[model samples]
Target: MHAISVRRVRRSLPRAALALVLAALGAALGPGAAPAAAAGHAEECSTEAGPYQKTVERHLKLTVDGVQSAADCAAIRTLQTRHGMEPATGRAGPETWRIVQYERAVADPSALTGCPHGTRLIVCVDLHRQLLWVWDGDHVATGPVPIRTGKSGYATRTGEHRIYERVEKQWSELYEGPMPFSQFFDGGQALHASYRNIWEEPGSHGCVNLRYDDAKRLWQGLRLNDPVYVWGTRGP
Candidate 1:
C-alpha cells in the first residue's frame, strides 16, 4: 500500500508541474492569452476554394486560378483581417469580395461628386456604394469605409441632414436592439454600430449601420450639429 501511494504521488508530480508552468505562463501572458492562442489557431488558412475564389484572386492580383493555394489564402486572409472581416479564414467568400469592391470605391470617393467639400467636417454617406466618409472640406478626414444602410421600404433618407443626437450606448425600444455609438442624423435613422454582419441582408431599419470599430472612431471625431450628407440610391 505504501509503494502504491508513492507511485500515485510520482504520477501526479508531472501533472502538477505542468499545471504550475501553465499558470505561470497564463499570468505572464495576461487575460488575452487564450484568445490570442485561439486567434493564432484560427489563422490557419482554409483549404477549400470559396465561391468567389477566382474573383478575389484577380482583385488581389494573385494567380487567377480558382484553386485555394497556400499563398492565395495568406494574401486573401491578410485583406480580410485588415478590413475586420469575420472568419478571416483566407476564404474568398462573398464578404471578402465585397470588401475588395469597397476598397476600390474608396480609392476615388471624389468621383461620386455628391459629397460637398468644405472646412466643416461632414459625414458623407453614399448609398450607391454603401460607403461613408468624413470630408473636411476638399480632403477626406476619415472613412470612405464600408457601411450598411436601410433596406428597400426603410431607405436611408437622402439629401442634407445634421447629427442632432449622440448616444454612446443606445437601446431602441422600437426595434428592441442595441445601437452603440448612435449618431442620429435624421429622424429615427442614425449612424450606429451593429453587432450583426454589416453585409447581412434585409438590412437596418433606416439607420446607417457601421462596424463597431468604425462607429466608435466616428463618434470620437464628430460632435453635435455636424453635417451629414447622404445621396444616391442603395446598390443591389
Candidate 2:
C-alpha cells in the first residue's frame, strides 16, 4: 500500500509542474499582450506633437474648415514620408512644412507657363513670379523653384540667352561672395546658389539666386549652350 502511494505521488508531481508552466505562459502572453500591441498600433497611426504642428493645423483648418477627418493631414504626411522627412509617423514637422510651402509656391499659376515650342532643353525664368523652371522639350525636368532676382538699382536682364559657362564653385569678384553651382548665361549675371534667403522680399544683385539644392539640381540638369529665357519686368 505504501509503495502504491509513492508511485501515485510521483505521477501527481508531474501534473503539478505542467500546470505551473501553463500558468506562467498565460501570465506572460494572456490579456496584457493584446493591449500592448494595440497601443503600439495606435502610436503607429498617430502623429506626434512638434514645433510645426500648429502651422500644419492652421493650414489644414484654413483649407478644410469644420472637418474632423484627417485626410488632408494624412496626405501631407504621406508626401513627407515619400520624401524621407523626419517624423513621418503622420506628423508635419519643420521639414515637412518647408516642403509643403515650397510645393505651394511652385504650383502658383504665375510660376508656370508653357515652354517655348521647338526648344529641346531650356531654362525658363519668370521674374514676375520669382520662379525658375527647367524644361526638356515639352516636359518639365526641374523647378518652379523660388528664386531671388536683382533688387532695386541692380536689375536682372530679361531675354533669351544660352548657358555660356558652368562653374561648380565660383567666387563673385563683383560681390566678393561665394556662388556655388553657377550657370552663367549672361554677362555678370548667372543662376547661382545664394547665401541669402531666396524667399526674402529684397533679392540678389542681378544674379538669379536659387536655393542651394535647387542650384545643384539645375546645374546637373542644364548643359552648356542650353537656352535660357528670362521674362517679366522688374517692378517700378
lDDT of 1 at 123: 91
Per-candidate TM-scores read 0.65, 0.55
Query: Which runs of model 1 end up more than 4 angstroms from their true locations?
Result: 1-55, 65-74, 88-93, 105-113, 199-202
Candidate 2: deviation at residue 3, Å?
99
- Given candidate 2, what's the lDDT at residue 63? 52
Q: Lowest-lDDT window of 10 residues in candidate 1? A: 1-10
* CA-lDDT, candidates in order: 0.76, 0.64
Tens-place lDDT per residue, model 2, 134-153, is 77866677877767678777
Runs of candidate 2 with Cα error greater than 4 angstroms are 1-111
Instruction: For each of the candidates, give the backbone clash count.
Output: 1, 0
